[model samples]
Target: MTVPAAIQSTFDDLGTPLADVTFVVLDLETTGGSATECQITEVGAVKVRGGQQLGEFQTLVNPGEPIPAFISVLTGITNPMVATAPHIGSVMPAFLEFIGDAVLVAHNARFDITFLKVNCERLQLPWPGNVVLDTVHLARQLVTRDEAPNHKLSSLARVFSTRVTPDHRALHDAQATVDVLHGLIERVGNLGVHTLEELRSYTSRITPDQRRKRFLADSLPSAPGVYVFKDEHGEPLYIGTSIDIKRRVRNYFTASEQRTRMAEMVRLATSVTPIVCHTTLEAQVRELRLIAEHKPRYNRRSRHPERAMWLKLTAEVFPRLSIVRTVRDDGATYAGPFTSRSVAEQAVAAVHEVVPLRQCTGRLSSKGTGSACVLAEMGRCGAPCDGRQSPDDYAEIARRVARALDGDGHQVIDALGDRLRALAADQRFEDAAVVRDRMLALVRAAARAQRLTPLATSPEIIAAARTPAGGWEFTCVRYGRFAGATVCPPRSDPRGFIAALRESAEHVERPEAPVPAATHEETEKILRWMEQPGVRIVDIDGVWVCPVGGAAGAQESLDDTMTDRGDAVDFDDSTISRRRPGLRAI
Candidate 1:
C-alpha cells in the first residue's frame, strides 16, 4: 500500500540544520560539588547563532549561605561579591529570557545543568525544555586524548587555540566554551555531521567504516517496513523493522547506532532490501518471520522460535511435569514457551508445592512394586510408583494439576499462599521467599498460556484499534496467525475496510490443542495489540474468552516478580479481563 504523503513527511523529516541552529553556551560557579547541597554563586552564558554573537547573560546569586573558604578562593567570588546580588529566584527569569529556545551548550554539562535544574525546583520556577548539548561529550568524540589529555574547558581551549581563555570566573569560562563548541562543530562537519540532530547523536565510538557505509541506506523507501542488510554473497547480515525504513537504516551509519555487532555487520553489508508494509503490525510480523527464517547473525532476537522450552505433563500412568523443547498434538497438558529450563523448573516446583503429583521421573504402574522415594516419605508425593496410591486416587491429583495448568490456578495459588503464610508465621522468611518466587513464576506461565490459548484457538477474529493519527487500525486474525491488517482513514467508512480485509486475508488452518498455530512470540504480539486500551472487537466466528478462574487474577500480584529475572518470559498479563461470548466491544 502506498503511504500517505503527510505520514511520509512526518517520519522521514530530520532535525534542524546545524548552520541554522542557535546555541547558548553556559557556565556556572557553585559553592559545592553536589547539586543537592550546593548553591549557584554565579551564572554566565553566551547566545550565538551562525557564528555571530547574539547576546550574553551574567549574574551573581546570593546563596543565602556563607561561601566556603576554598570555593571563594577558587572562583574569586567571595561572600561580599554576592552579598548584595539577587537570589536565584530573581536571576533565573532574566537568564532564561536571554537563552530563549536555543540549544544549551556547556562543558561537562551534567555538572552545570544539574545545579540549574535543582535551583529551578527550589525556586518553584518552570525550566524551559531546551535541547542541551555537552561540549565535553562532543570534544571527546572529535578530539582524541592524543590531541589533548582531557576534554576539560581549559584543556580544550588550549587545543582549539580559542582567543578567550577559560578561567575560574563563570563568564570567561562560558566565553571559552562558545569558541570550543564552534571548533568541535567544524571538525565533526568533515565526517558528515552537519545537522543539530546528528550533532546531538554524535559519539566518537562510531567507526570510520560505518561512516563510509552511509550510502547503503540511500536506496531504502521512506515508509513503514522491514529492511534486510545483506552481505556480498546474498546472505542476510541483519534484519530490522521501522516506521520509516530510510531514516531507521540511515541511523546505522551514525553514532546513534551503538551496537558493536551491528557496526561490524554494516561494514560487511553489500546492499539493503526493503519490504514496505501497509501497517506497523504487518511490518513487525514480517520482520519476525524473516528473522526466524534467515537467522541473521546480527539479528539477536526472534531467530530461533524452536528453541523455546515448555513444561509438559507427561502422558503416563503417573503424570509428572517435565521440560521439553517441542509442543505436540499428543494428549497431554502443556504450560509454556518458557525462555529457559531453569524457569520451567521453577514453575514445576510451584505446582508440586501445592498438589502431590509424583515428582519421580521413573515409569509407574497401578500394580508396580518399588521403594517410595524421599518425596513420598516426606508427604510431598503420593508414592504412586510403589502402588501405595491407587490409579484413581493418583488420577485425581493429576486432574488438579491439569486444571491448574489449564487456567483454574485457584487451587494451586491458594495452596501456595497458605503454605507461604504458614512458613512466614514460623519465622522461616527465607523459605517463604523461595515459595514466593516459585508461585510467581508459576502464575506468570499459567497466566501467559491462559491469555493466549483462547485467541490462538479461535477460528476468526476481527478487531480495530485507534491509531495515534486518529485513524482506526484494523487486523484480521485467523486461528492464531495475523492474516491481514489495514488502516481506515480518519473520516472514512471502517466497514468497507473491514470487509475488504477479511476477503483478502490469508487462510490459516486450525492448529491442534497444546500447540500454538503461530510461534509464541507472534501470538504474544497479537495479544498485546488486541489488549491495548482502545481495541474493539469488530467481529468473531468463535468464542474469544479466558477462563474466569484463570491465573490472570493471581498474575497481577506476581507480575512485578518477572521484572528482575531474565529467565521467565515477561509479557503484560495485568489486563486480560474475561470477555463475554460473541459480538462485543472491548
Candidate 2:
C-alpha cells in the first residue's frame, strides 16, 4: 500500500537528523575545580553542523581575583592578561546568545557545565536547559580500550588523527573536542544512530529486544492521541499520550527511552493501539481515563484518583468531622479531596482547634449515654457524648465548623491566628510553626474547594484559549467535567463551531453539591487549564461565584506569610465576554 505524500512526509520526519543538529563544543577555564567557590577565567566554543564549522566564540573573562601562580603557568592566562577583559557577568549573556539552544558538547562536560551554571546563578541569569553531550562518556561507549589507553580528548584526538591538537588553552581544546565528537558520530553512524535524539540518548546501541518491537509504532498516526502497549494476551502493559502518536511511540524503541520497566514492557508488547483526539487537552483527559480504567501495570501516575481522601462532616444529630475516601450526596459539608490521610488529619486538627466539636469515635445518639473522652476533660471537645453539651448546643458548634468548611473560614483563621500568636509570645516557636502549618493546610483545602464548587454547579461553560499558531483551543465544560474540546483556526468564526459543539458535546449529569462532576484530580486539571493566562470564557450558564470572605482570603494570607489578604472570590467570567465581544455568543 502506498502512503499519501502528507502522511509519508510525517513518517519520514520522525526526529531531527544528526547531520542537521547544531553542536556547540565548549570549554571553560576556571580558578578552581569546585563550581561553588570558583571563578571562570576564559571561555571557548566551536559551533558546527553537518561536519562543517559554523562559527567560533572565544573570550577571556576577568576573574576579578588573582590567578593562582601554578594555574597561570599552566595555561599562560595571567591575572594581568585578564585585567582589562570583560567580567563573567558582562560576558555570560553574549555567550548564551552565541550557543542559541544548540546541543553542547565537551570533554568532561560536568566540570565545564558546572562552572557555567554556578556563574549563571551568581549573576541571576536564567540557565538555558540545554542537552549536554560529554565526549568522554561517548568515547567510552563507542571507542574500545584496545584503541586508546584512556578515553581522554587528547587520546581520542590521536586515535582519530584530528586537525586540531588539545592544549591547556580553551579554544584549542574545544576545537579538538569537536573533531573527537565527529569521529565518535562516524563510529555510531553504522549502528543506525542517525538522529539527534538517538545520539543524545545513545549510551550504547538499542538492545536487540527493543529493536525488534520498532514495528509497533509503524501503523500509529502522527497526531494528538493516546497509545496503549499491550502484551501477548492483549492486556494493556502501558498507556501514554502525546501530540504526535507515531513519533512518540517510536521513541519507546529507541536509545532515548531510558526507563528499565519501559524497555521490559516494549519487549513483552504484542500490539500498539492508538486513540486519536482533536486537541491536546482531550488526549490528556483520555489518557487519564484509560489509565484509571485499565490500571496498566507499567503506568505509575493518575491510576488511582479514588485513593484521594476527603474531610466530611458526618450527617448526624451530634455531627463530627470524619475523614472519608469518597464524596457522596449526604447533605454534609466537605473540605478536601486531600492527597493523603496525614494532610486530611492536619486539616481536621485545624478545624478541631477552631471549633469545640465532639472527638469520640463511638456513635452518640441524642438519647444514648456515652462516656466523655480525655479530649472533653482538656476542653477541646463539646462532650455531647456525656450529655454535658446538649444536641442543640452541639449543633450550633457544628454550624460554625460547617461554615468554615463551606468557604467562610474567617472564624477558623482568626482562632488559629490567636493561638499562633500566643505560642510565639511564649517562645514556643516549634508549636507555633505546627499551628501555622495546620492552618495553611486547612485554608489550602478550603480554597481549592471554593474554586471548584462554582465549576461543579455551573450547567455549561464554553471557554477558549489562544494557541501560539494564531488559533484558539476551545473546551466545553459541563458540571466541572471536560465534555468536549476543539480548535478554531485563526480568523475563523467560533460561534458556529461552538453551536455545533454544544449540540454534539457529551451530556454530563449534574453532581450533588460538594461532590464534583468528575474526580477531584480531573476537575482540578480542567480548572488549571481554564485558569491559564489566555483563557476566555465564551459563554456560561448558572451562577458561578465564590464567597466574598471565604477561605481564599485565608489561603492568600497563608501564602504571603500570615499577612496581606486578597479577595478570594474572583469568579467574574463576564470580563472575558466584555473583552472579546466577537467570541461571546454561541
Candidate 3:
C-alpha cells in the first residue's frame, strides 16, 4: 500500500473484482538492496487475467555496474550476460508499455518496485502510476506458517503445487508468483473476497464473536450522540461520542481496526446504549460527563479530573495567592488547573513581581508576632508581615493583583515593559530578557484566566467551529462544562437545530462550585475550539468575557521580539503559579 512517490498511483477502486482485472506479477534481480547504490540486472513479469496466462515479458539490462559475486552466483546472471543486452533506459519504456494500467503483483513488492522506481528517476522518465499489491501480505492473510512451513515463494510453490519453481532468477520467480497469486485468489474467493478492496482490507484477526456483535449496533440511532458499552453486570466498559453513533460502533467490530485492547473491550461489551444528542456540542459535553461519572475501566483521559492542580488566591482579611490541588466553594479567586505544579508556580511568581504580595508560606496577622521575610527585605513585598503596610494599603495592592488576574493586565505588563526598557538601556539585555519572560508568562496566565472565567461561570454559551470539510460543529456549554455538541452541514439552515439544542441545554445539570476540574479542562477545550480560524460565536446566554483589544496582537509583538515559538508561555524558568482571578463577593 506504500507506493513510492516516484510511482504515485491514480486512485484504484477496490470494487474492481479479481476476475475482471489484469495482474502483472513482477520480479527484479538487483546488484544490491538500495536502488540508489544498486542497479537492476534483470526484470521479468507474467501477465494474467482470470487465472489464465496472457503473456510473459523478460529482459536483461546492462546495469553499468558490476554485480555482487554472491548475487551473480545465485541468479546465474553475470555482467558478461548483460554486457551485450539493452540498457535499463531502453528496456523500461517497453516494460511500462507492456504493464499499462494493469494491477501489479510481486512478493515483497517494495523490493522489486524500488529498483524500477529509482532507475526511472535516474533516466528522468515519468514513473507509471501502477496499482500495486504485495503477495507477501496476501500470502500471510491466507497461508499460515503451519500450512506452508514458510511464506517464501519456494515454500509456497511446493504448497500450492506451482508449475514453475523459484530459482532466484527473475522470470522463474515471477512465474511462481503467478501460480501463488491464483491459489490465494481461490482461497480468498470462498470468503467472499472478490473485490480488490476486500482483498486489501480483509483480515483474519477478527473474532467470530466480534462479527456476531454487529447486531448490537444494527438498531443504534444514526444521530450524533454519546454511546456507552456496558457488560452483562451493567458496568460501563467504554464511552465515546460520535457524529454517527451507528458507524462508530460498527468500526470496533471491523478487522480494519487493529487495536488489541479495543477488540478485547468489544468482546466484553454485552450491550451498547446510545444517548441521542441534539447537537455535536451536547454529545461532546455528555461524553465528558459520562466518562467522569462512570470512570469506565477502559476509558482514559478526564477520568480523574480532580487530579488537576490550580493556583488560588485565599479569601482572607489579607489575601495572598497559593497553589491548591482543588477548586473550592469558599469565596476565592482561581487562575488555573495547570497541567503540573511546576507550571502553576511559574504563573504565581509572575504575579508577585507586579503586586508585591507576600511570598511567605503561612498566615500572619497584623497584630501577630510574624517577622518580615527576605522578599520583604528586598522590597519585593510591602512588608505586610510586620504591619509596615496597613490592611487598607495592602487591600489596594491586592486589588491591582486581582485586576491583573481578571485580565486587566495592562498595569503589570506596562510596569514590566518600563523595567525591561530600563534594563535594555543599561545594556543589560540578559536582565531585560528575564523581565520580558516574566511579562510574557503573566500575559499568558492572565489571558487564560480571563478566557476561562466566563465559561466557568456562564449559564450557557453556544458556539460554532467551521470544519475543513465544510459545515460548523456547534457546541453548547454551561458553567464551564460541555452541555452538548452538534454539526451543521454546509448551506443547511441551523435555526431549528439551534433551538432544539437550546432546549436540551436546559436539562444538563450544572455542577455546583467547587466546580469539577474537568469543567476548567472543558473550558480550555472550547476556548481552543473557538480559536480555530473561521470559527464564530453563534450565541450566548451569559457574558463570555475576553480581552477587549485581544491578547493575540500583543502576544505576537512579544513573540517577534523574543522569537519564542511556544504558543503558551513555559514559565518553568520562573516557579510562578498561574494567575488567580479576583475573589467572588465575600
Candidate 4:
C-alpha cells in the first residue's frame, strides 16, 4: 500500500521534533451522534512524548440526561452504569492537565475531537489547539491495498495479528488502535521512513494510535499491602491498597469494558509493584500514608483530607482523659482515633488490669457521691465515681495504662512473668497457677495488639497437615512436645492455613526456661486446653485424637481406662483405632 502525501507530511512533521513533542491518544464513548445533544459516557487516553509513553487516563462521566436504550445497546452504557460517575464538568480540569500540549489522536479523530471541543466551549473552557491525528485515515492508506476492502479496528487487528478479544468499547478500541499503529510504524520503517519528522507527518494524516500497553504479570501478594504502579515514564501512576493485593490488581487488568478507567490503566501500565503486609489494618495505614505523600493521579478516592481523632490520657494532677483530633506541639499523650469506638474500648480494656481506671461511659459525679460503677466492683476501676482514689494516684495509673495501650507489651510481659515466678517460688501453687494463666493471657493479648516491630525477627516456619477425620493434626519438632491441633476450615486453602499457623506461632508462649516435668494434673490441664474448640492434637505418628469422640470399643488395649497414676492406659495402634473407630491419621 502506498502512503498518502498529506498523511506522510503529518508523520514527518511529528518526527522532526522528538525533544518537544507530546501525543495524547484519545477515545470517547457517547450517547449518540450529535455532539451537542449526546453525552460523553466514558473517556480513555494515553499520553506519550518522544515515542515514550508518559501516562494513561480514563473516567466515566455522568451525562446530564438518561442514556438512550439503543445507545446503551451500542456502547453497553446503561443509565445505572454511570449513575455514580462524576459529570464531565467536574472531570474536565484533571483531564485537561493530562492532555496538556499533547497532539490528540483517535480512530475517527474528527468525530471525537470536534465533539470534545464543543463540550469544552459549552463549559467556557478553552478549546484545545494541539494538532490531531486520525488512525482511520492512516489505516486506509496503509492496509487497504493488500487486505480486505474495509479496515475496521478488528480487521486491522487480524492483519497485524494483534490479540484483541472482540469488544468495541472505548478502551478496547483504543487498545486495538494501538496495535494497528504499531503495524503501520513497522511498515513505514520498511518504506524508508526513518527520521521523527517523517514518522510524525505520516501519523498525522491517519489517526496515530497510542503505543503504550499495560503489562501486569506478577500475582499481587494476598497480604494486606500498599501497591504503586508506575507508567513507562517511571512516574507513579497510581497508589492503592488491598486486603489481597493480588486479587485487586488482577481485577483491574481483567475487568469488563464498562470499567473503562481500569481497562485504560491496564492498557497503559508498564509494571506492577507491591509491598506485602501482615494485616489489613497495616495495609490501610500504609495506603493512606503513601497516597498523602505521593499524590498519584489515579488515586482520587483516597485523597480527601480529614481530621482524625485520638483518645489522650494526660500526665497531670487530675490526668484528664479526653478525645482530641489534632496533636499539639506539646501535649499530655494520645492513643487512637482507632478507626472506631469499639477499637478504642478494646484498647482501654487491655490496659485496665494495670491501670485500674474508670471505664464507665457516664461522667463522675461532681459531688463525689454516686454508687460505684460495675467496673469499680470488678476491680477494673478505681472508684472514681465515688472519689475514693486521689487524682495523683489515678494519674500515675493512667500513665501506665497509656504505656500499655501504646503496645509496650515487653514491659507488661516482664512484669507479669516476674510476679508469676514469685508466686510459684513461694509455694503458693494455687495462686501460682492463677498468675501463670493470667500471664499467658496477657501475652496472647499483647501479641494480637502489637504490630510487628521492624527489628523483631520473622518466626521459624512450622508445618502442619489436616487429619482425614475433619481436624488438622501435627507435631512441631522444634517444640519437642505435641502441640494441640486445630481444624482447618473448609473454605481455607493451604496457604491460609500456613499463615494462620505462623500467626499462632507468634503468640505461642514457651514455658519458663528450664522446662518443668509435667505433673499428672498439669498434663490433664494441657490435654483439656487442646480439647477446647478449634484445637486439634496430633501424636508423633500423625494420629488425630479428638475429645468429642471419647475412647470406646477398643480391641487391643487390655487397660482401657485412666490409671491410678492419672495416665491413660497404654495402647498400640490397633487398640487405639478400635477404641476410636473413626480415628484417622492426618
Among these predictions, the greatest TM-score belongs to 1
Reference-based lDDT, residue 555, model 2: 70
lDDT of candidate 4 over 27-145, digit per residue (tens): 89898888988889888887766546688887788998898888888778788979999999987778888888777778888889877888899889997688777877768767765
Model 1: how far is 545 from its true place, Å?
Answer: 2.4
Ranking by lDDT: 1, 2, 3, 4
**Residue by residue across 288-393, what tens digits does model 2's lDDT show?**
8889899999998878888888888888998888999878888888987687788788888988876888776668879648888898889888788878888888
**What ranges in model 4 sit over 4 Å off?**
1-21, 49-52, 195-197, 200-586
Candidate 3 per-residue lDDT over residues 1-586, each given as its tens digit: 9975784322231146778889999999888888799888889999999888999999998988888899988999988999998988899999999999898999999899888888889889988879888988888888987888878889889888999889998999999999989899888777666667556666778766776676788678777889999999999999999998987887776667798888899999999999998656567767877887899988877787666666687877678988887677777776655666666676687777666888777877866357878987788988877878888888888877776666565776677778878999999999776666667765655566666666776777777766656876777777776666667788898887678778875455555443532455566766665555555667777675566643333454665665454544445322222222322110
Candidate 1 per-residue lDDT, tens place, 111-192, comes to: 9988988888888888898899999788877888898998788899999898898888888999999889999999988887
Residue 420 alpha-carbon offset, candidate 2, angstroms: 1.8
* Estimated TM-score for each candidate: 0.80, 0.73, 0.69, 0.32
Give candidate 1's error at residue 269 in angstroms: 3.0
Sort the candidates on TM-score, descending order: 1, 2, 3, 4
Supply every candidate's count of residue pairs whose N, Cα or C atoms clash at under 3 angstroms.
0, 0, 21, 24
Query: Which residue pairs show backbone clashes in model 2?
Result: none
TM-score of 3: 0.69
Error of 1 at 71 (Å): 8.1
Q: In candidate 2, which residue ranges exceed 4 Å CA deviation?
A: 1-134, 144-147, 157-183, 195-197, 205-219, 250-260, 562-586
